[model samples]
Target: MTNSKLLKLPSQRQLVDRLLHLIEFNHPFIFLSGKPGSGRGTLCESLLNGLPDTVRVVSLIGSAAMKMADVRQLLLQQVVARPLFNPQDALADSFFRMLDGKPANLLLLIERTDELPADLVGELWALCRHNDTLASPHKLAIIVCGNDVWCRSQKEALKGRAMPALELEVAPLSPPEQRIFLYEKAKELKIPTALLPKPKVEEILNGANGHPSAIMQSLEDIMTDRRPKKRQAELPVKKIAIVLALVVAGLLGLSYLPLFDGMGKEETREQPQEGALPAPIGSDALETNAASGAQASGSAVNGDQVARDWQSDAKTLPKKVESETVTTESTNYEGRRVVISDEVVEKLMTQPNVSGALPTEVVNELTGVSSAGATQKSAPATPSAAQHAQPSAPTAQAAPKAAVPVAVAAPKVALTPVSTLNKKPKNHYSIQLMGASNTQAVDSFVAEHALAGKVWVYKTRFRGSPWYVVVQGDYASSAQAKTAIRKLSPALLKGQPWPKSFAQIQKELKQ
Candidate 1:
């Protein structure tokens, strides 16, 4: 990645800032060619805030061996924002379908284009060349970035064929530029200057030259050395001395024996024929012989019978508990799912340890959710405070504030954003969903749903269990709130739908 400080360089600033103008007034297929480690990926991220507010940049990486189907799948994830899709149509056409009613301009950035097969590059070029006709009128622009050598080769190979009219090359940073980039990155990473010795840092800089990727690696090495890493606990000096003494004593005892010298010399007679010795039988042959002997024995066991016995035992074994999916009836506007957090995770989020991001394993452990997004993958382990108290104590006390929802209608009036909902609002009504101990699950639910109205996740400790209640769209009266819920499909109400006044919500939130 390019260090943010690289923006200070004149060439990078000019190159990135001009992308919008070049695409809008000139050509649609803009090629940004750079060698590996030239900060090509970081350049895309750096340009995000500079583009016109009307344009939304959707970035996805292209694999070296990507098929047409893989390219389609990538587009589906970025543009549609869905993890799963049925591949029935061309991805390019499906991409246009996603933008059918959306108003924003789109810039599709396919990175590592050099690694992509030539056919895919050609297809992308054609898509950009005709996006206005194929999709919305001039709503889409395409950028295909890759290594300079391969890109130049592809362009030359095409000769008089269609090429990106606004082709630009991202050159490697100069030596001084690399040092400045490293300093900026160190500051951003919060690595102290004193932790990196000048002589050693200079050695890293000289080795890295001007490559951003290399400098990042050198900086990581410096940071790692700064950490108080545990050394392999060394053996006591007495133990090491004892081992040495044993070896020396054995050698001294052997020197007094004449058989030792004779044994060492008998090597001459045996070594004369060693060169013509035959190779020993391999382990495979030994195993085959052993198996054959077992079959020939009178008490031979039947392999088929053993297999059947094992299968019978397996059939009797209890099955593992899987994560259950909570399927709510949707009006075809929502695009997210929810999992019931296991008891462990509920307890974790109920506590106060969740201030920033947690390790993924810790998240899974506390939430009782697996990587598959299942809430109850297995039962939450009972905390053993009398035994392993350290981990359980903090977990019994932590909670997160974020959760999710699907598409809902915009509110008639401006309501409080989720952040300001910490205080109980003036008495009004809202819809309460089920509570979860996992703040991550709650956060994901609201965000993935893109619930356009005011939504709040109430934090409360009920009967010692931490609960986060997700409330959507506050109304002025119980009749209006109940009326709003009744107009929806029965499938939408997975839990009991009741109108909760602000006072009631505040009571639950403050509990």
Candidate 2:
């Protein structure tokens, strides 16, 4: 129906004109032959539209099961403009005789004569020839339309009976005519011309085989299935939500970065001293103690001045520690409590080696560690030791350290590999979807179609270059493969995929 207007193009105008002339001249009999869907009925309809008012037209469909009596009954019913309740066989003959006496011409249009029985067709032609020989005042013309089979049958009958009849054929559209027809249909459908690019148009043309009906169907399919291009402003809300979720997840991931840093650092344990401040927890606590020790050492060079300064600092340390200490039962590595009493302070002040910096032996006795780097700084400050140690005490109350190693296992989904397709029997078939120059293009195509892990891609040589071919499911036979093509998505269908035997695919794979 979409191609109805295309049947009247200039390429077919002459055929319509010829048929009209033959009908007007009262040709005894005319045979119109064409392949099914070549527009035979459409051409005859055009002729009927242009006929004169005086010509009476009666159209009938021929069938293999129809008898001459049935034909006569049908014709009589049309002539009388009423149903035949109980018509006699001779009634049709009487009607024809009555028509011969009138001045008006009678035209009979029979469609699908290929399905009519041989005897029935011959009888109809005999009636037309008899009417011609009678030279009646009213002329009669019979125009029959059929496929190539009907044309051959009629020709043989004519030779056998030495009958005269005009033979005309309705041909398929030529290549140029087909192109014109497609462009016209595309315009009628309001499809953009650019959508029908040269390669795509060529594919459609080849697939349709120049049939007007097929071409029109293909164009209509394109118009129906065309997808609108997505714009940034029109992005789906789901995708935006997913992106925001990922950003939140990334922020959460940063919290675990410190754990990895902790795993790589060497763990050292320090023994708590009697009447000393709590041991450090995190690196921040260690750095605070180091800074305080350095400041204390830079104050003076004489041991007496340092002891006077130290004594004043030592008296306030225990009070500060008592006020800030956050008590917890677990205090081994993460938190420590140590008190430095007046006895240790007096002992340190009495030593002559305790000058600008505390002696290394005294520093190690209090701090329980000795390093070349530590001897340069003054002993850890008495007041600040308790301040830094309290901040790290809360870390001991956190979840157990063993829980850090507990990780969630990633999920796994099973997928059939593409390479397994090669082991299939040679007789098995598959739909070849597309071919690409590189595997990335094939992967992109699969991912875009949401076909990843469902379809298969294999390498083959094409035009002497490495080519990747994507194929659909394996099928037992080519017919099954072809049927599966119809079930593919519209986007995949546009590529014009075809069925191929595994034998052929494997042969190419070997190359």
Clashes of each: 23, 5
**TM-score against native, each model:** 0.40, 0.40
Candidate 2 local lDDT, 1-511, one digit each (tens): 4325754577578887887787777455778888876777767777887788988887888878887667677776665565444444454355665454555577888898777655556666666655555555356677888887768677666633234776788777889888888888888888897789999899889987766777777887787875455665766889989999999999989989998777665342343446645333332322335566556545543323331123333544454454332334545666665555454566677896665886655666467564333332343555377447676666554334323342222332232454686698899998989988976677667767777667777777888999888887889998899899999889999999999898887788779
Residue 465 lDDT in candidate 1? 90
186-231: candidate 1 lDDT, tens digit per residue = 8877888797678977887888756777788778877676535788
- Which parts of model 1 are misplaced by more than 4 Å? 1-3, 64-66, 76-104, 132-137, 157-165, 190-198, 226-511
Candidate 2 ranges with C-alpha deviation above 4 Å: 1-4, 63-69, 82-94, 98-100, 135-137, 159-163, 224-511
Q: Which residue pairs does candidate 2 place in steric collision?
A: 275-339, 275-340, 276-338, 276-339, 276-340
For candidate 1, the TM-score is: 0.40
